[model samples]
Target: MMIGSSNKRLMSDINVTPFVDVMLVLLIIFMVTAPMMVQGVNVSLPETTAQPLPSEKEHLIVTIDQKGQVHISNYPVAMESLRHKLSKILEGRSDREVYLRADKKIPYGNVVKVMAEIKAAGVEKLGMVTVPIDETPADR
Candidate 1:
């Protein structure tokens, strides 16, 4: 009787291909959904020919929906108490600038009322957020 023994060492190198594939998939998923994660009060801004504001620093945002609802950031605020709430939010802040975004369907009177409240809150500069109008060379 003869016994034969074959010598073969087991593979020791770790496979990193799966790890890299998983990381790439996660990156793609985040990129695809990142814009959807931006939290803010939704409003259809009016179109204008005004230039876009330069973003030098963060400013507080006040949103007014078509239903005449006021919101500070993402929280809902009563129109009557808008001034007090804004004052609280702007307490001790040197830059008294606030950006207002209101739906195009909102009435002019409502917007003016909201603006008055903002002014009463001691906001020095008021910025109205509007969608830029696209113009062709022929329109210019």
Candidate 2:
């Protein structure tokens, strides 16, 4: 065998097969976990025909479940302390806006009580969150 004529050759091309495999795995993982990532208190919202309001930034959301438990985001808050908690949360915020989500089965009086507490906290604007009315053919 000649000294300079070796069978082994230098490989300058990159092996992209492993990279593509890793990327596909990551994509599948995200797809599988995406729907499970939705975070909120479960409540059957009242249906409405009103247009949805545009959201520019993250705002405070107060939710009341069917069992009448109050929540700020995902944390539970007692009705008695709602005003104090809201005030403390909005102490430095300029907008002082809040959104309320209540179960449709909840009594109107309970909803009014929560609204009163929100107003007492000095909130400037209060928005109600409702589900859009379904326009499916079967419903009609």
Candidate 3:
């Protein structure tokens, strides 16, 4: 008795359907999560459609507490040294921006002082952060 062999082609093609499906899923996920992604200090931003701020990039955070305490990146810095520190931070980053976050109760003078220091550091565009007023009790 002899056995007969039949010719059957082996599938040699790669299936790209799974790859496409995965990419589509990733795209949807990113789209859904894009709005939820917040990229900076979580301050109750002050209102005023003063135009939106530039998206997070390397930035210098200068905080002036209500008591007139000055902080640079959360580190307590002397008023005299603020300029030097800012200069160092902006050393390689000539394009870097400085964002000032001060307490609402902070005196205008204090805020101005911080801005002055930032300007002295040679940074032209200094952005300030504030909390927007809320009418809703829940927000309050």
TM-score of each: 0.68, 0.69, 0.57
**Model 3 lDDT per residue over 1-140, tens place:** 55796768998999999999999999999999997664333333345445545585766788776666777776778988999998998888868678888777666787787798899998978888754444343562
Q: Can you write out model 2's per-residue Cα lDDT over 48-92, one digit (the tens) per residue?
A: 999888878998999999999999987899999999999999998
Best by TM-score: 2
TM-score for candidate 1, please give it. 0.68
Once fitted onto the true fold, the runs of candidate 1 whose alpha carbons sit more than 4 angstroms away are 1-37, 135-140
Local accuracy by lDDT, each model: 0.87, 0.92, 0.75
lDDT of 2: 0.92
Q: What is the TM-score of candidate 2?
A: 0.69
Error of model 2, residue 26, in angstroms: 17
lDDT of 3: 0.75
Report residue 68 deviation for candidate 2 (angstroms).
0.2
List the RMSD of every prediction in angstroms.
Answer: 5.7, 4.9, 7.1
Better of 2 and 3 by TM-score: 2
Give the per-residue lDDT of model 1 (tens digit) for 29-87.
99999987776776778879999867877779999987889998868899889999899
Off by over 4 Å in 3: 1-54, 135-140
